[model samples]
Target: MSAIDDLADQLARDALDAAARLGDDRLIDDISKAIGASSPVSQEAFVSAVRIRQALARGRAVMDSRLTQAASQKAGPEKSGG
Candidate 1:
């Protein structure tokens, strides 16, 4: 992975660890309340991120299929003594 990906992965792991260590009912309640009170901009950003992820997944699937098809075509001629 790239350096940025490694850093982001580390940060996410650390954040999850910190959250797990809270182990407080009140803190969990407060976090739930805060999450339910997200602003419109944050909501929009979350939706946009979801959409982008979906688009990327679809693009990757298409690229993978195309690559597989190209490889099969290239191998077909070779196998046929072309």
Candidate 2:
């Protein structure tokens, strides 16, 4: 795979892992709060929270990918990098 594709795939896997670790219930709660309010201000806040969460997920994925790659490199040539 190209380096960019590899990186993306690795990132996706990491995000999935983090999501699993954090548990779905918490995520659901956060999403619910972000989208559940009535007032315009509250709705705006919710939207912002949703955006923040999305960004965080992306960050987590990137971090996970980097860590996986680092670990594989440390393990030597027999192992593949993420």
Candidate 3:
């Protein structure tokens, strides 16, 4: 596969993994309701909103991982800065 296609595939897999982790029926219902409510808006706006939400979610996940790693390092004994 081309580089872009491979990246897309990886992203799809990651999204599936994240969705599986959520595994909350109520959360899914809420998301569905939000999307349904957006249907009255122009198609462009709906697509933009979805993309923005996804980007924000990805950013949150990255920030969460960095915070967790920093906390773990701080909790452990100091290591040589080698």
Candidate 4:
């Protein structure tokens, strides 16, 4: 695999490890809350190779939302000339 492919594979495994260490139930809860899913997605349904990939995607969304909010808050004072 190319370097980029290798990195992608590594990240997927890392996410799977994180999910497993945290437990499927907990990861599902956090992921649901983060993604605002209408219904809970079953952790058991995830394949080993895909668990981390899915979790990372969901987690990244939450992180992006929080970071955007923080940046907006920080910019508010500047925008107001404060």
TM-score of 2: 0.48
lDDT of each: 0.53, 0.58, 0.57, 0.57
Residue-level lDDT of model 2, residues 1-82, one tens digit each, is 5554454445444444565788764654454455455444444444444456678979999999999999989888675588
- The collision pairs in model 3 are none
Which ranges of candidate 2 are over 4 A from the true structure? 1-37, 78-82
> For model 3, how does the per-residue alpha-carbon lDDT over 9-59 read when each residue is reduced to its tens digit?
454444444656887435433543564575533333434444555688799
TM-score for each candidate, following the candidate numbering: 0.48, 0.48, 0.46, 0.38
> Per-residue lDDT tens digits of candidate 4, residues 1-82?
5554454466446555677787764654464354334423322223333655777779999999999999999878554555
Worst 10 residues of 4 by lDDT: 39-48
Worst 10 residues of 1 by lDDT: 41-50
Q: Write candidate 1's Cα lDDT for 1-82 as tens digits.
A: 5554454445434444455697543543353345448654433343344345557768999999999999989878454455
Q: lDDT: which is higher, 1 or 3?
A: 3
Error of 4 at 32 (Å): 23
Give each model's clash number. Answer: 0, 0, 0, 1
lDDT of 4 at 34: 49
